[model samples]
Target chain A: MMSDNSDIDKYYDVVVVGAGPAGIGVGILLQKLGINHIILEKTSIGESFRKWPIETRFISPSFTGNFFKMPDLNAITPDTSPAFTLLTEHPTGEDYVEYLENLAKYYDLPIKTEVCVDTVQKKADSFVLTTNKGEYKSTYVIWAAGEYQYPKTNAFEGTHLCTHYSEVDSFSDLEGDEHIVIGAYESGFDAMVSLIRARKVVTLLDDGDYLNLVKSDSSYSLAPFTRDRIEYVADLFDYYTETKVTSVEFVNDTYLVKTANGQTFTSPQKPINCTGFASSLTLVKESFEFKNDYPLLNDFDESTKTSNLFLVGPQVKHKNALFCFIYKYRQRFAIVAEKIAKRMKVPSQAIEKAIQGYKDNNFYLTDLSCCDDECTC
Target chain B: MMSDNSDIDKYYDVVVVGAGPAGIGVGILLQKLGINHIILEKTSIGESFRKWPIETRFISPSFTGNFFKMPDLNAITPDTSPAFTLLTEHPTGEDYVEYLENLAKYYDLPIKTEVCVDTVQKKADSFVLTTNKGEYKSTYVIWAAGEYQYPKTNAFEGTHLCTHYSEVDSFSDLEGDEHIVIGAYESGFDAMVSLIRARKVVTLLDDGDYLNLVKSDSSYSLAPFTRDRIEYVADLFDYYTETKVTSVEFVNDTYLVKTANGQTFTSPQKPINCTGFASSLTLVKESFEFKNDYPLLNDFDESTKTSNLFLVGPQVKHKNALFCFIYKYRQRFAIVAEKIAKRMKVPSQAIEKAIQGYKDNNFYLTDLSCCDDECTC
Candidate 1:
């Protein structure tokens, strides 16, 4: 329905790129702030979540405690819950897409789907976005395009020989009795667990002991959801820690996964590359200065080099605090909105009321230093 | 290890006669207030949770977001989460039991297991309890005995002809291929979903059309977690709505289920009774005033008939509010603790601090009227 719309080439106060949770989140706040904004998407709303592996689920759990002040952790808005909308806790990609689509419809945010933004360039006082649809001019741009859809292809040589974890629709759809899984992060463990459940023999290669490392903060350790599955399937598969896969090659209908320690494993099919995803900022690398592979942002999450240009997704980080999860990054949506609203001169009373709503629910985390506390138990 | 304690024979200020999440929750607050309390469990701590059907999981989702004032809904304490402790959102009965056990140990709660309290007699400003192990005396009694273990047998005649949902360890352990499930609540739908997952044809008999009814409060409606699974399995099973089971008869090696509307279903195996659980207040029916099979309590959850006797579990219903969930029942734990502390003459500063913690996290829900609002979208 959105593909037929010719509104992609328009002028707006802010143009939010990508229609995932992050994009829709900012759009909702933008709507509340009464900002004339439009969300541009390459496909449809939450296309990345729709493209997630069918068996993959959010590590975060959601509960319908919106009225009680405990909104769903994965919810972009305060009153919504993926658990309530999709009726599941650990929502699959499709479940999440439904949630995003519902949020977009509920708020009636202006979003143009199937409009890909190929380039973003700051010209004078506006960001001239060059897209397949046309050139879009906006006073400010919120780069909310998430990272899950963009797989890290350059992690190893001959990477095309293996099936990226993000590419597989479902593990059940794969026709293989024995397979090799490269990388031992959450995705790697997820694929291994899925394969093990389907009565398949798996060999997992890990560069570190992520399974044994237990950290109170989710940013540093394996999620409890992954830990639970690993406990059940740990012994079912062969695991080699400290073994990093350096390259992969397909020869004679067999894929050879070569590791850094001069070890090679053979799989009947292509090895699953669960090495995780790359930053979506790779599309606009010239806009912001990189601080250790992460964007340099001000307190408002706007690019330091390019003022009025903001980033509101998982690629955001401040020192040691990793704002990669939905719960963490969703905090900045209100903050980013407030900053833009203040600059746009939206009434101070309205801005304060809108921002306070987020703060009241403990969703606004301005201080990143306090998040590193270890569990007392 | 607490079974070896000789303190079982001693007197106490409060005897919380249950070591599940409720008892542990009250115990933690009591410990903080320096109150003298001992948790008495009929079996081990969280035995009811341990007895739940293995395939059945918590309808509430658990997330570890305690520091930011959004504690896990399933957590008894502020800092703990079933997700972090058990590593799952919808933890199975065993997983929940482990979380409860961990809470008991972490807080060093004084709990006596395998000591069933048979009867209670108020004697001279004190309650004398006759247990299987010994007689115990206490000034106050908190009945934290949960309801899941006690299945309602007399809901229909010949109920013994069916298998209670809680009796089976897991659905996979069920030997029969064809089964008739009586009662279509959460437990009934849970059995149906599990049976369908296991490729077994199931016939679920419900007294009402609970599937289509959507309520804002989870206590009155089917949880989103259950709803999600029901969506996938609703078509797979034969669901008979508004069909109340009147009797179950076993003849010719076939179990026959008779409903109120002259409908009878037969299964080769015994019918599984998913007819929910009964309150554990049967032991103290003489203590509280009953209003249509419900206990009447004061503002502090103390019995109106007996001043010192209090209720702090799922059975505590007030007006239109049903405190049947961990999040709801957990709110009143502090209220009960505060009332008990004031009576025990504990330091007001300590009591206020202990209770304030619950309120700070929005765990102290003093008003029940606000819970009735349905979702607009």
Candidate 2:
């Protein structure tokens, strides 16, 4: 790979290979501890947030989405009511991205954008990472690039007729009147909703169970604010359910999806594969013995097969279901950051307090209702 | 007294009077628990907040200033930082009032405004509250009129020539070119700053024992903001040494003050009094035995001298060192509210948790750090 000479061969206490939420979160915690580290992003800071569709927003409540030991929303503005200023709403993708940018700027985390890490290998008492920009040696390495970095498509015939969810961030590049979204999960449903909002017919293809945005009691089963957001979107789009699209074909300037229900729906919109991405460790997959496409990890989040390598973020979900959302990611990231900080002997209360605060949110907001306005509980 | 036929004297499970933070807070808790209660306010909801100076803003931090059970700032508006939207670096009083109004509306608190209670006398089974609109008989009564209702001035010779701090909301109100602000406390400092900003030869007069806003560090002190506000008038005024204004005389086209230092400072501007207000409980004081000229309360926030009657807000601090600041009011209000709610058999959590949250100001914005572009925090 071609190399850039910027800060070549610099050694760091910890090196994180992503500038997304997980990486930036770790960087913020580490920065607060005065730890010497660097965040290398192949694209830009909050690249994933930037890639989300215009109508896309955080699926979680804003209260739990803040960075570790960072400023909460109330500190930024005084006129906002605590409920209105803190926890009762969801923000759009563009706004969420702007918020991330503001957070990154506030902490002044040393993030190096456009520095793509090629491989991370273990060395004695440390880890060495080779990137397009330079080689970095660190006592600890966190892989937060996440699954979205690599798009995984099935080995079906005419698979090239579809585009992954990450690639369809902007619909302006595509010329289509209708669409077939392949998946019944959040990504696929989100895409179908987006397409429908654009005034196009969308055939959602999935064999799995369908999760309704609205729960039985009209509340969201996810976060409280998620229901509000889903309702807000429902107000803009109408949706019909349970039609599983089995196959799609591109012919006669149209995309045809044959559902399991013996119905063939033809549309001019291109089929988009919002099946989600797999772990982006293709370059190092051959060198490690993987379990279900994920490297085995010990209790400290250190890879069982390797001493210096570690994993965080959604990639950890490849081994377990945690670390997939903001609330969960908050816990998992803090756990790993604390483990690494302890190993490096960094002195700061940021990581421990963050984890404690995260755990506190689950307890206070969900369990206690005595002070809750609606429950008087 | 003539009563409307609609005035059906009915007994309620609980009756909370005053719809400011204290009243609404109790209402929110009661409503959530399926408890039946009626909150009554003599004026609009949060009348005290509404009556604050138009240029006044919350002195407390946004994060810690919210009612218990309300959401944090981030949960309300994800995209907009709370510090920017709710808590300005220095908020005008109007902002807090608007915020309270929004909170009351959002919670749908059942508050009957414009129903001034003439007297609250305890009956055998319930408390009979005689009001201008009707008679309310309830199991419990909460008195939360707060402290800033009546101005307290020393009866010094010629003291009648000065105006109280509450009346001087802005610097534009004064017509003279010079002034003497009597008091070294927040209000005194506030008045002196405003006068100085208005281009007047302003002198701050007080005993100087308990007037200064508490400061531990000059760098992080609220003094700089206070000082900056006053510097706008620095060209015309000078801060006087610790001097007690023994008397004031309104001479022809000027006001003269006799100080402890035997020095008389004459100014063309009318002397402004920054002496703050005392509790508004004169009418009810006769019913209860006085301790230090104030009503004494037991552990349940119940008057030791009277059963079923509770004292909340600044009245508890009457003739005491507390109740002089917003922080103290917030704490005392929560404690009394919880005690009254529990006394009315309205289920509530331990008072410690409610009081604990009140003491921490991070919940509000002005006392918080915003995750913004230039934040060093």
Choose the strongest candidate by DockQ.
1
CA lDDT of each prediction against the hidden true structure: 0.84, 0.56
lDDT of 1 at A178: 92
Q: After superposition, how far is residue A92 of candidate 1 from its true place, in Å?
A: 3.3
TM-score of chain A of 2: 0.76
Query: Candidate 1's error at A282, in angstroms?
Result: 2.9
A282-364, model 1: which lDDT tens digit per residue?
A: 89889999989999999889999999999988899987777888888888899899999989999999987777768766578
Q: After the best TM-score superposition of candidate 2, give how far the Cα of residue B195 lies from its true spot, in angstroms.
A: 41
- Determine which window of 10 residues in candidate 2 chain B has minimal summed lDDT: B74-83
- Regions of candidate 2 where Cα sits further than 4 Å from its true position: A1-6, A54-108, A152-159, A184-186, A189-197, A204-240, A251-254, A281-310, A314-321, A331-335, A347-377, B1-14, B17-128, B131-140, B143-377
lDDT of 2 at A87: 21
The clash count of every prediction, one per candidate, is 0, 51
Q: TM-scores across all candidates?
A: 0.87, 0.52
Residue A296 in model 1: lDDT: 96
